[model samples]
Target: MSVLSAKFGHRICGLKDGRLRDIKTSSSNVRNMEELEAERAAQKIEYAAQVKMEQRIHNKLKIVKQQFNSILQSWHHSMHQLRGKVPGFV
Candidate 1:
């Protein structure tokens, strides 16, 4: 009778071992999914920040270009006045 009980206990443990391994694998998969989600969120935040920085740089460059064009126009007008004052200056 004792020998039969020991065999039965061993069989139960064997079945439980397979179930335990499956549970551990499932837990590991959940952890990996969570890590991937966190990484994706971080990447999104970084991309937003980069886009904002690019927009700021573009706006600043536009302002600088406008100022440069204004200065060039002023210089051109001054040159035209000087040319008019000179005799036979093409």
Candidate 2:
């Protein structure tokens, strides 16, 4: 059996067989297309925020690495200069 409903779409009969879960009862509680679109918008916003945060972290890491390398090079240069000043230092 089948029922054509303009408000709730097609309703299948006999399939329910007097079962509670098989019946929709009403369209009020059922999720609509608008709700699904809203959820997708929220997810896209969340994803963009996460990507921005990750990019900031990556940029900070690069700056710290550059500073460390600069310090190491300066220290090495000073050590070589000190060695040249020492007497009989090969």
Candidate 3:
């Protein structure tokens, strides 16, 4: 027979026990669904936080690169001045 038919018959034959067990299983199923939904929401929040952190890191890297380029340009200018002072510097 089908599972439902068996459960129904069991409910009739074992009255109190079968009914209580079925109710407990149903309640647990609801709890499991709620817990799964909560976990999904938490995961989404964590993913958003990680994305924000990556954006911050990217901005910081861009700033650092700009600073390095500026420093290099300054050094080049100073070297050109020193070379100009030397006699016969190519």
Candidate 4:
């Protein structure tokens, strides 16, 4: 049968065969709720850490790109200078 049907059968057998008891759930729910809240808090912390890491990586990449572009521009300038378009090294 389906999962729900199987679970229902188990619950029924448990209740009828003295393997389980009829009990109130009010006393046992706080722990589950607390665990769920803790999980959410942990997820938020993990997400913040990930965002910080991504920001740092983006900043590094931007700096690297700027440095590369500056080097390329300098190389172009020197090549043009050697061709005598300008008689000075800029």
Candidate 5:
């Protein structure tokens, strides 16, 4: 006998046996697909938020680096002026 025959025997000849099982399986499959879609949507939202946060942090660091470079240039200019004032300084 086939697998279907073993499971349902003469019941397979009726409309309720195999049909009902197929319906139940299809319904559960739909529910599982919906749940998986919802989870994927949530993950996408989280990933977008994370990318935005990383961009903000990168911009902040760029500003900090610019400020540090400005300060370093100013310090170097002051040192050059002091060297000029000091006698025998090359």
Candidate 6:
């Protein structure tokens, strides 16, 4: 026997309930698939958020690296200029 539930769906059946253990077991086995589906959706949302956060962190690190490289290049250029001015300094 099948039941109708607007929440679970239009029709519900316990095909895996072993014929519902004479109806009781069957109805029990007719669990709501909505729970499992809802959990999957939540997990997907969490994974997307995690990915977004990681991308943001990666972008920030790239900017910092570029700034550091620029500073290092300027410092090297200054040292090179100073060495040229000092006759004894190689």
> Given candidate 5, what's the lDDT at residue 63?
100
Listed per candidate, the RMSD to the true structure in angstroms reads 13.4, 6.8, 9.5, 7.5, 10.0, 6.4
List model 4 lDDT by residue over 1-90, tens digit each.
112122211322244434544333343464565689899999999999999999999999999999999999999988987878755645
* Ten contiguous residues minimizing lDDT sum, candidate 1: 1-10
Error of 1 at 36 (Å): 0.7
lDDT of 6 by residue, 1-90 (tens): 554333332354445554532223333334546667788999999999999999999999999999999999999999899899998876
CA-lDDT, candidates in order? 0.68, 0.71, 0.70, 0.68, 0.70, 0.71
Q: lDDT by residue for model 5 over 13-34, one digit each (tens)?
A: 2254445222223555666767
TM-score of each: 0.66, 0.58, 0.65, 0.62, 0.64, 0.62
Candidate 1 CA-lDDT value:
0.68
Per-residue C-alpha lDDT of model 3 across residues 1-90, encoded as one tens digit per residue: 112332312321234435422222355665676799899999999999999999999999999999999999999998899889987765
Pairs that clash in candidate 4: none
**C-alpha lDDT of residue 40 in model 4:** 100
lDDT of 2 by residue, 1-90 (tens): 343332343244543455322245445434564578799999999999999999999999999999999999999998898889997765
Candidate 3's TM-score reads 0.65
Candidate of highest TM-score:
1
Q: Backbone clash tally for model 6? A: 1
**What is the number of residue pairs that collide in model 3?**
0
Per-residue error at 78 for model 1, in Å? 0.8
Q: Candidate 5 clashing pairs? A: none
For 1-90, candidate 1 gives per-residue lDDT tens digits of 111122211311224334311112355566676799899999999999999999999999999999999999999998899899998866
Q: For model 2, how big is the CA root-mean-square deviation?
A: 6.8
For model 4, give the 10-residue run with minimal summed lDDT: 1-10
Q: What value of lDDT does candidate 5 attain over all alpha carbons?
A: 0.70
